[model samples]
Target: MPLHSLNHFKSVFIYDIFIQPADQNYLTARFLRVIGMHQDFFWHAQQTLEKLFKAGLVLNGVSVKSKSHELTKLLPIYEETLGSDAFNSFDKPKKLKAELWSDTSVKDFVTKISALGSADARYGLVGYQSSKDDLFKLDQLVFKLRQRTMGLDWVIGEDFRAEENLQHFNGKTYREFIEQNPTEQIRHLSIPYQELKSIGENTQDLFHAWNFEFQRKSSDIDKIAPGAIAPELAFSLSRIDALLQNIEAFDGFDKEFVPEGFKWLLDNVKVSSHWKKMIETYLSESKK
Candidate 1:
């Protein structure tokens, strides 16, 4: 490969760095939250979400150059780029969407989290009123948005074209190009393929565990809940519903929701092994 081709090839891995910083910010924010440092926690939480937001933009072929850290600005761009239908992957996604975009909950989250991105929040110059409820909402946002940054890779050879003769990666999907190319001989990239592969795989695993394993979605509270309890008869309704939300509503809520619960549900909730293979076959065929 020519010198320019090598440099272009090396530039392909730059997108991978976004996830690293996002993960670092997330870990630190969780640490701060555990120690009851809400201000510092919000500070790091803003950064973590900002990085992931920008990463999603870049991955989807959007320019984030000179973008503001305020999610108010970035979020509209994100919604336009990815669109509202992006939440279709989540269970009871409309509820989640309303929580993020339409409801007063969104106002509280966006304004407060956006304020935390300011220098005042960083230096402890201002005290924020965000509560643990905000933290749980933050966890949900991260879990939902991080999914956008997870799959696929973005590396365009045309953007770095010195000419037509030098094209090592082109006209192929990311995984296909990486697999077939003789990148081992090229010492130009700081990271080898194995390291890049490991990072991509491990990030998804870590992301799922860190964000959701112990966390419960509010929708989980409605697994057996009625559509509406009668408003006319009320005093005992509040206490009864409170008991369900806090205690016996369903499987994946509060103390019942944990990594062990997650694993056990996965292990036990599936159809029997004999039919699982058949289900997998149907799924594969449906995709085809």
Candidate 2:
């Protein structure tokens, strides 16, 4: 065979066979000769091949139809050149989409991909011609499953028994269940009960402030003298002004401070009033 064809053969074998258990020096000698390298090139080629394999590719049982008899000798050469860290650098897991609940193939792929060094290998497999949508779906499924698992106990909170029941129905359609048990929908989505409760408490606080301002303003206007402004009315107006100032100081409340404030409130604020009680109840029953 021509030198180029021989080089291609070596590349294929390295990626397809040699890395498994092939003879090293012979393969390196052949590879160096095919590339028109000096006698010293064999060691360099061997080292380079080893590095490539270590960077994460393996070909343990790869098929090579044209060279069945030579496989035994080639396999040892490939194995000697294989690197040790052949499966390290990989991506971490991320959240999944809601649609993968029913995909068995996706679930299987996730299981297999997860067995690989990192969740990131899925990204590489995802737009390839052979596994495109299936791989994507698997990635989505893994993310969703992990999210659900992480949020499980916290989301379910005191309702750990109910959470266990929900897990039993993991393969069931979430939409169908929600439709049948509309009341349960909130709980399913409300995992991390403490977080949900914190959100509810924050909302109540805003509502109470608004109501208090309304009532104070009404009382002030009612008690105002025909020709004189009541002191209570003046005080109420001042309080409203201060509250407005506070609100203004928090321009990006919804996005920035609100989430942190909710966490802080949940952790440090005591549940004392009726409003707090109501918020606690709402969170206790929200989805997980």
**Which number leads on lDDT?**
1
- lDDT for model 1 comes to 0.51
- Cα lDDT tens digits, model 2, 175-261, are 334435533422222121122322223433423333435553443334323222223354223221232234345332332332232
Q: Which candidate is the best by TM-score?
A: 1
lDDT of 2: 0.31
lDDT of 1 by residue, 1-288 (tens): 121332232232223345556767877787788767788888888888888777667555565656777877887787777665233222223434444432335545766788985779889888777653565666667665565552234343542442243355564334334345423212121321222322124433323322334434433332332223224554423321232234444343333222232232223223345544543543454455
lDDT scores in order: 0.51, 0.31
Which stretches of candidate 2 lie above 4 Å from their native place? 1-107, 115-130, 150-288
The Cα error of candidate 1 at residue 32, in Å, is 0.7
For every candidate, C-alpha RMSD to the true structure in Å: 23.6, 30.4
